[model samples]
Structures are given as structure tokens and as C-alpha cells.
Target: MIGFSDTSISKIAKRASVSAATIYIYHENNEDLLYKTYLKIKGKMSEKMFQGVDHTRTVYERFEAIIRNYVDFIQSFKDYFLFLEQIMNSPLPQKWC
Candidate 1:
């Protein structure tokens, strides 16, 4: 899901040992799956970003720690970062604004 367009529903289903129809039960289409996956990844990233920084620190300090965490995550997960970067560069619907 992170790699986005390079993969097809059949590929994902086969990789997960499920049928394509089973995937449809959870997502209407590839874009929907991508959106859901993005949310999941973002949540995990945020959790990691806030893992060890002291809450008593200043807002700026905490934000800097988050930036460091974000950079580390991108470096560690280049493919996931690239997929999100591509999606962000893509044209979005007016409703998204």
C-alpha cells in the first residue's frame, strides 16, 4: 500500500494470502486503500516522533525532537516516505482543501 500505484489489488491480495474480492470488503479501490494506509502510517510515525521527548520541554524543543524523529523515519523507510511524497505532490480534490 505504501508503494501505491506500482502494486495492484491482485498482487496485494496474493501477497497477503487473500482473494482480491476480500480486499474489496475493506476498501472500495486502490486510492481508498492508499488513503487508509497513509493514515495508518502517519499515526505510527507520530507515535514514534513523540516517544521519548520530555513533555516538560518547551514547545519548540518538542517540535525539534519531532523533526529529528521524522527525518530518522524517512531515512529508515525510504519507500514509505517516497510514496507519501508522491501522493502529496499529486493533485487533490477541492474537498481536500
Candidate 2:
């Protein structure tokens, strides 16, 4: 429900059966919405990376599981994964970089 394409606020409002003002009430601006969406995606990625771990496992096994989980998470959310890759590769604000 969160991932919207390159559409205007009015279009999104109509699709969601809400007013533009309602959307504004929830998000200060389009950038705010995008940031929130990114946070949601990042949280999901973090959760997936920590999906399975047992204290009894060997250290090597735990490391391998973590790597596999990260790969699986990236595969599951490829768009968000690509977005992250772009951010990391781009020259941006010092705070962001």
C-alpha cells in the first residue's frame, strides 16, 4: 500500500479514497512520505537479516546464516535494495552519505 509510482498527490489521494489534505496531514511533503517509506523498507531489511540465530550454532554457521539472510532480504525487496545501492553510490549530503 505504500509504494506509489511517480504520480501526483492528487492522484494518490484519489486512488486511496482520501483527500490531498488528508495525505498532507499524514506527511509534511512528498519527501517526508518517501523518507518514511525508506525507513519501513530498511526496518524490514534489518529484520530479515536477523531472522534466524541460535546460540548453540558454531560461529562460522552463524556468520554464514547472517550473510544468507542479508542476500535473501535484498532479493525479496529488490526495488528498495536498488534504491539503497543508488544512495550508497551517489554523492550526497554529508549527513546522508
Candidate 3:
């Protein structure tokens, strides 16, 4: 994959089958796009990580359920998980988190 340093708005827009102006219609700039994507993926991961977690269950059971759900998310959406990992190490998190 092309690293973010080498990526440009036009390149991303072309890859996404949209024009650069189209991207700007929703994002202020490249960093905004990346930050928004990070938020979206993080929301998805959070949802999956707590899905079907029963509050009525014992503490241990609840913890185990959360862990299982997280494992399932990582296994089923490996790309999203990896993206999150990459973003966590980037400056975007410091700027937005």
C-alpha cells in the first residue's frame, strides 16, 4: 500500500472514483479525511466490541463476552483493525483523540 506521506487528494479521489473537489465537498483537507475515517472505523470497532454483551451476566461473563466480541471483530474485519492500529500510531490521534 502507498504510505500516507506519498498519498494526495487527487490520488485518493481517483482511487475512490470521485473527483478531488468531491472529496473537498465533505472534507476540509487530506488530514480531515483521514481523521474522519479513523472516527468511523473506531465507531464500528466499538460497536462490534460490545455487541451482545449481556448486562445481566456475571462480571466475569461480561468481560469474557467483550473479549470474545473483540476477537471476532479483529478476525472478521482485519483490515479495519489494522487501519485503526496504524492511525493510533499516527499524529491524527494526537490531534483529534
Candidate 4:
């Protein structure tokens, strides 16, 4: 697998068995694609982090539950978790805020 820095739209298209033009139809550019992918994964992670956590519970309890959920998410989606970490540490994260 190519690292994020080495990946290109054509590579992604080829892997997905689609044409480069098809990828362009959905993403304006690679940066846009990465941004969207980051958002998608973050959304899923957030969902996991909040799953079954009672809002009415004490702050400590909620925090603990969220941490547990985060651990579960990391274990279940290690690749996604690593992707998120990589993106978060990159300059692209500035665009997110």
C-alpha cells in the first residue's frame, strides 16, 4: 500500500477499479478527497465514542465511558484510527478547524 504522501488520484482510481476521471467527478482534488475521508472516519469514530453513553450521567462517568468506547473503536478500526492520527498530525488538519 502507498503512503498517503505517495498516493495519487490515479492510484486510488486504479485500486477502486475506476477511472481517474471518475474520481475527479466526485472529488475536486486529492486534498478534497483526503478531507472528506477524514471527516467520514471522524464521524464514525465519534459515533463509537458516544455509543451507549448516558448524557445524564456524571461527568466522570461519561468521560470514562467515552474513553472505553474510544479504546474499542481503536481496536476495531486500527487502520482508520491510524489514518486519523496521521491526518491530525499533518498540515491538512489546519483545514479542519
TM-scores of the candidates in the order shown = 0.73, 0.66, 0.93, 0.91
lDDT (Cα, tens digit) per residue for candidate 2, span 3-54: 3345568877898999999999989876566567667777888888878766
| Clashing residue pairs for model 1 | none
Across 1-97, the per-residue lDDT of candidate 1 in tens digits comes to: 4445577899989999999999999999877887788777777777777878888999999989989998888898887787667767766322245
As a TM-score, model 3 comes out at 0.93
lDDT of each: 0.79, 0.74, 0.89, 0.93
lDDT measured at residue 41 in model 1 versus the true structure, 0 to 100: 78
lDDT of 2 at 93: 22
Worst ten in a row by lDDT for model 1: 88-97
Could you tell which candidate, 3 or 4, scores higher by lDDT? 4
Summarize candidate 4's per-residue lDDT along 1-97 as a digit string, tens digits: 4567898999999999999999999899999999999999999999999999999999999999999999999999999999999888888888667
> lDDT order of candidates, best first?
4, 3, 1, 2
lDDT for model 1, please: 0.79
Clashes of 2: 0
TM-score pick, better of 1 and 4: 4
* Cα error of candidate 4 at position 76, Å: 0.3
lDDT at position 43, candidate 1: 78
The order of the candidates by TM-score, greatest first, is: 3, 4, 1, 2
**TM accuracy, model 4:** 0.91
- lDDT, candidate 3, equals 0.89
Q: Which candidate leads in TM-score?
A: 3
Give the residue spans of candidate 1 off by over 4 A: 1-7, 15-17, 92-97
